[model samples]
Target: MKVGLKLNEQFTVSKHNIVQVTTFENEFHLALTNSEYLVISKDDKDNSYYYTHEFNGCLIEVPVNEYHRIQRELTEYFGVEIQDVSSDETKDQEQPEPTA
Candidate 1:
């Protein structure tokens, strides 16, 4: 996930601009001007599709294959790790207590 990025670099993720790289879903989400979201779709063929979504956009499509890579890039660029929700935590929260 470490891509050797510096925090002071212009490419660094900031409050106004963020490079949302979704690794598990292999997609890139760019938050553009207000009400605009740019999504980059990655496929097995290495084909990259660009999409623009407005505030009223109905649906968002994120390619599954490029998710992992996207996440890695985001982490590298932001110098942070994406916290994953553990299955054990989910089970613990969902299961009811047994009677003593």
Candidate 2:
């Protein structure tokens, strides 16, 4: 489910660095550090999800579908490579049909 976020919400990034999320009419404001990182977490209830730093608190909770979309966006924005663990599991689960 999509978690609605309000303007002027502060999310911790580092011990001394915090990012403020704001939306002004048709514009959105978000500040990321030079060494920023993105981490997504899926809530146990209702498959709710959020994106945040590995060492920080939840920045925003998005819909389950948005989680992967946001992850891809972050990967491209940050120019980093993220391994897909789920894909590997799916590959391993595929088995050849037994001859009858």
Candidate 3:
């Protein structure tokens, strides 16, 4: 399963499958497939959230100013990686496995 994401102007738009989620202290670690991971943390002072995604040893911080929107999305997507058609090509693509 995978989850498609298009966060505003952020160019990190793509589908990701989360293999594991670990919380340590105030930050959370989300290990995704394809050599990627995300570390998310919340700022209680302003009730905002911040995160950084790493791929191939490179990490980029994603700035999200909308607290509620992001929070809602995170809650909705967390533990919710599902197959999604993020693009037209994927919509028409065939499944990898053939069912009986």
Candidate 4:
């Protein structure tokens, strides 16, 4: 399928309700809002790298190299900071504090 057609399908089913699509650094970036975006690109070798972002709930399929390239571009362009959260952090927050 053509890249445009693939992007259309992604927009139709995206949970974030993609409102715009643009190209940056030769990759497609689908925007749901100013703070939320999804990047898509075609893999040069396998053409089957697919994954979903847990936070934004966006689906993406692209070449491994393109994935990293676009990720960096998105971060830089949007000034987004990607943080790693441990499961322990969530567990600690879920527990009630001890009463005095």
lDDT of each: 0.44, 0.38, 0.46, 0.50
Candidate 2 C-alpha lDDT tens digits along 1-100: 2232222134333312324323322122344455443333332233222332433432443444554554454445445643344455566677666799
Off by over 4 Å in 2: 1-39, 43-56, 87-91, 94-100
lDDT of 4 at 6: 30
lDDT of 1 at 85: 35
User: Which pairs clash in model 4?
Assistant: none
- Tens-digit lDDT track of model 1 for 1-100: 4433222213333434553433223334556446454444444434323333423322234344344544555556667874333467676888999998
Judging by TM-score, tell me the better candidate of 1 and 4.
1
Alpha-carbon deviation at 55 in model 1, angstroms: 5.4
Better lDDT candidate (1, 3): 3
Which structure is stronger by TM-score: 1 or 3?
3
TM-score of each: 0.34, 0.34, 0.37, 0.30
lDDT of 3 by residue, 1-100 (tens): 2366543445343444656655543344556686666654444433133322423332223344442344455557664532222355554575566689
Predicted model with the maximum TM-score:
3
**CA RMSD for every model?**
9.1, 11.5, 15.5, 12.7
- Please give the range of 10 consecutive residues that has the lowest summed lDDT in model 3: 51-60
Sort by TM-score, top down from the best: 3, 2, 1, 4
The best candidate in terms of lDDT: 4
